[model samples]
Target: MEHDVPSLPEEIIVKILLRLPTKSLLKFRCVSKSWLFLISSYDFAKAHLKNSNDDRLMFGSKGFSMDLYTWSPQSAADHSAFGGTIYPPLDQNLLVQRVCIDCPLYEPHDVVWFEGSCNGLICLSSSDESLSLWNPTIGKAKKLPNSGTVLDFDYYGIGYGFGYDELIDDYKMVESLSFEPFAGAPTLDIQLKVYSLRANSWKTLLNWPGGHAFGGSGKFLNGAIYWSVHRLDGPIEWVIVSHDLSTYTFSVVHLPHLHNEDNDDVNVDVKVLRGCLEICCERNTHMDIW
Candidate 1:
C-alpha cells in the first residue's frame, strides 16, 4: 500500500508557527535546525510577541518575586486572581531587546520595579531618586534625566507613549516629567519632556499649571498617554498628556472626578493593568481599575 504525504509551503508553516505562544514555539525548535533558526529570528520573535495580545497582567513583590495573574471580569468577587499555578520566569530575551533599543533607562536599581505599565512598557524608578521607562515584552528601556539640581525631591512622575507627526513617518516617545521640590517649596515645578527615539535625547516642553505626576505606568491610548495627577486642593485628577509621535508636541486633557477623602489615602500609584492604565490606592489591597 502506498501513502500520500501532505505538502505545505514553508512560508505558510512559518506563519502558523508564529501564531503559537512562545512556550509552544520554543518546544518546536527540536523539529529541525532550520525550524530553530526561524523561531529565533528577530523578525519572527517580534511578530509573534506583537500579535500575542494576551492582555494579562503579572504582579510581583519583593519577597515573592513575580507571579503571573489574570484579571477575570466574570469573577466580580475577585478581579485580580492567579490565572495559573505555574509562573514563568522573567524573559531575559525580552530584557536584552529593551537594553538594545533603549526602551527604558536601566541604572543600578534606578529602574526599580514599579506597578505601572504602558503599551507593553513598565514604568520604573531609581530607588526613590530617579525615573526610567521599560518595554517588558521587547526589553527596551530609556532612562529620564534628573529634573532639578537637588536630588532630595519627594515625588516624581514619568510617562511614555508613541505618536505620529504629519512631517515624519516614525513614532516618538512622549515623556512627561512632574515633581515637587521638597516640602518647604511654595510652588511645584511641573515640566513635560519629550524623548525622541530617533534623536536619542530629551527636549523640554511647556510647563503646566498645578502639580501633576504621571499616574502609575502611563497608558498609551489613541496616540495619547494617560496619567493621574493630584491637585493642590486635595483632589486626585486624571490628565491625558498627549505626544505627537511624528511632530513630537505635548498637550494635556482633563479627566473625570478622582479624589481621596483621607489625606494619607492617595491612589497616585498607577500602572498598566491588563493592557489598560490603572491605579491602585491601597498597596496591600491592590485595587486597580482601568
Candidate 2:
C-alpha cells in the first residue's frame, strides 16, 4: 500500500527552514526546485542573514584559499570579553568548511589582503591593484573596476577599508595611503580616496588630519570607520581618526588616558566590539582594553 505523505504548508516550511543552520540549509536546497529558488532568492538571503544565528569564523591566507569554522555557542557557558573578542571554551570540536577562492581576474600568487566585509559580502585586494567583492556562502565573486593607482598596504601606515552606506544603499571602499615627502609638505603626507559601488568610481578626499595613520585594518562600527593615528607635532600622542560613512566628515576619538604618563611607548589598536568602538593598548607586558 503506497501512502501519499502530506505536504507541509509553504508558510510552515519557510518558518522552519529559515531557522535551520546555514550548512543544512545550503544542502537542503537540492531537495526540490522550489526549495532551491527560495534558498537563492535575495529576500531569503536577507532573512537568513538576520534570522539565522549561525556563528561562523572565516580564516584566510595569502593563497586563494579560506577555511570557515561554524559552531554554536554554549547556552550555559561563561564567556570573557577582551579587545572586541569573546573567549569561549576551546575544547569543543568545530566543523571546518574549506572553500576554494578562485580568481580568474588576478594571479593566485599575488599577495592578498582582506579589506573588509559587510552584509555577508567580503571585499579583498591584492598587490596587483585588483579589488574583488566575494560572497563565500554563494561561492561567487565580482571583480571591481580599478579605482586608480595600486594602494599597497605593505608600506607602513597604508591601509584599505570597505563598508556599506545604508543611506544610499551602496557599498564603498576607502584607501588611506602615505605619500612621499614633497617640498612645503607637513611632517606627514597622507592621501585618502573613496570608492562608491553605485558611482563606480573613486573620488579623492581631503588629506587626513590625524598626522599619521598606523598601518592596520580599518575598524568599522556604527556609521564610521576608525584607524589608529598618532600626532607628531608637539608631544607624541596616539588618537583614533574616524571617517563618517554617511556625512563623509572626519572626527577624532580620544584614547583613554594612560595611567602612567611615562608609558608613552604603548601600542594602540582600534577595534569594534558588540557594535561599540574599543582600543587595545599594549605596553611592555601589560595590556588594557578601553
Candidate 3:
C-alpha cells in the first residue's frame, strides 16, 4: 500500500517545489502525471530558471565526439583553479553530455556551443550532427528531433541564430547551411531551417541568396538575430544577415564603407552592445568598428 501524507494545497506544493533542487524536482516528475506535465511546461521552465541561484560554466569535451558540459565551479578551498579570484558561494549543478565518438565533420573547435542564450536557455549544434536547447540553471534539456542536412567539411559552412520572439512568447533557432554539392555546381547552396520551442517542431524557412553565414557569430538585438555572411551570389561581398523572429523574414544590413580594394580577405563579427548593434571588420592589417 502507498503511504499517503496529508494533502497540501497546490499553491503550497508549487512554492515548495520551487525551493527544491533541480535533480529532486526532476525525479519527482515520475510521482504523478500532472506533475510531469507541469514540470515540462515552458512557462514553468522560465519561472524555475528565474528562481534558480546557480551560475554555470560550460566547457567542451576533449573526446572525439566534442560534446558540451556545464558545471558550477567550486571555491578556492575545494578547487585550485580559483586560488586567486574572489567568488561568492554558488549552487552546484553538474550536467554532462554523454559522449560516444562519431567523428564530427568539422574540427572540435568549430562546434557551436556559446552561440547565444535567450532567457537563460542555450542552443547548441554542430555541423548538422545534433541540435538541442538546454537550461543549465534547472538542469532541463530538450534535444531537437533533427538537425536538417550537412555537407562535406571541405565544401561546407554553417551558422546558428538563437533568440526569443517576445510577440509570440516563443524561442526560436535558425540553422543556415551552405555547401557545394558537385564539382561543376555552384559554390554555394544555402539551406535554411528554423525551430520553434513553443510549437515543439522544426520548419523549413525561405532560403537566402547564395552566401554562407559565419558560424558562432550570431548576435541578438532589437527582436532580430544577425549573422555575418560571406556572399557568393554575384559580386563577392561580406554582409550581415538579419532574421526577424516575429515575421520569419530576412534582410541584409550592409557594413559601413571602408575604402579598400587590395584587402583580399575580410572578417566580420557582429555583436550587441548598449542597446544597439555593433559590427567589427578586419581587413588584412587593420580593424574597423562600426
Candidate 4:
C-alpha cells in the first residue's frame, strides 16, 4: 500500500502563499524544502509583501531609547473570544523588531529616532545626523552614507523621512532643512537632501519645495512619505506634505477645514490608516478625523 501526498504546482503554491499572512507563511516554511525555497526567493518575497500591504501596523516610540512593534487588528466578531479585552500583546506575540541593543548615542536627548517601516525594513534617523536601514526580520542593518552637509544647530533645524522607490527598486531617506539666520548668516535658507540605499550615497536638492516646517515623524503610504507641515512665512496653520520616493517630487495636501474657535488647544496629527492618509484633529471636547 502506498500513501499519496497532495502536491501543488509551484505557480499555484506561490499564489496561495502570497495571500497568506506572514505568521502563517512562516509556519508553512516547515512543510517542505520546496516550500521554504519558494518562500525565500526574491520574487516570492516581493509578491508576498505586496499582497500583505496594510495588513498590519508598525509603530515605534521615541522616549528613552526606541522600540518597534507590529500589531494586527482583529475583526469585531473576534472580540468575543478576547473576553472584552482587546489587548493584542497579551493575546498575541508582539514582534519587537528592535530594542536599542547597542545604542549609538550616549545621551538619549542628543539624538532622536525617526522611523519609517516598509516591506519589512525600518529606516532610522538621529537628531545628531545618523541614518540607517534595517530589516528587522533578518536582523540586518546598513548605515547610510552621510550627505556631507554639517548642520549648524545655531541656525538650522532638520527633519527626516523614509520610504521605498518601486521604480528603481530602492529605498530613500529625505531630509528637510529649515534655516534661521542669526548674527552673520543673513540669508535664510531652506534645503533638502535625499539618500539612496541603492546607491549608498546622498545628494543635496535645491529649490526647497515649500518653506513648511515638518512637525514630527512622517507616515509612509502609497509609496510616499507624508508629514504635517507649517508654512514658515505664513501663520501657524498646518498642511500635509507628500514626497514621492520613486520620482523624488513634492506635493502639498490641504488639511480638512476645521471650525476651531480656540486655536490654541487645536492639535493635528497625520497618520497612515489602512493604506490611506488620515488627518486627526482634537480640540477641547470634540475631535474631527479625516
Please provide TM-scores, in order, for all candidate models, with all chains considered together.
0.55, 0.75, 0.61, 0.74
* Model 4 residue 250 CA deviation in Å: 2.1
Considering every candidate listed, which one attains the maximal TM-score?
2
Per-candidate Cα lDDT values, in order, are 0.53, 0.70, 0.68, 0.69
Score residue 86 of candidate 4 by CA lDDT.
29
Residue-wise C-alpha lDDT for candidate 2, range 223-276, written one tens digit per residue: 688888776555657778888887899888676566485654677888664467
lDDT of 4 by residue, 1-290 (tens): 99999887878878888988776877888988988898878888888786775556667664566655555554423334444332334335332233453333234555546467677777777656677777655556777777787666577677677788888888888877777656556444767888888888888766456644566666778788887866656466777878888777788877655646565456666878676778877678877778
Using lDDT, rank the candidates from best to worst: 2, 4, 3, 1
lDDT of residue 251 for candidate 2 = 89
Worst 10 residues of 3 by lDDT: 93-102
Evaluate model 2: give its TM-score. 0.75
The window of 10 residues in a row where model 2 has the poorest summed lDDT is 75-84
Name the TM-score of candidate 4.
Answer: 0.74
Give the range of the ten consecutive residues with the poorest summed lDDT in model 1: 92-101
Ranking by TM-score: 2, 4, 3, 1
Error of 2 at 181 (Å): 3.2
Compared with the true structure, the alpha-carbon lDDT of candidate 4 equals 0.69
Q: Pick the candidate with the highest lDDT.
A: 2
Of the two candidates 1 and 4, the one with more favorable TM-score, higher being better, is 4
| Better candidate by lDDT, 1 or 2 | 2
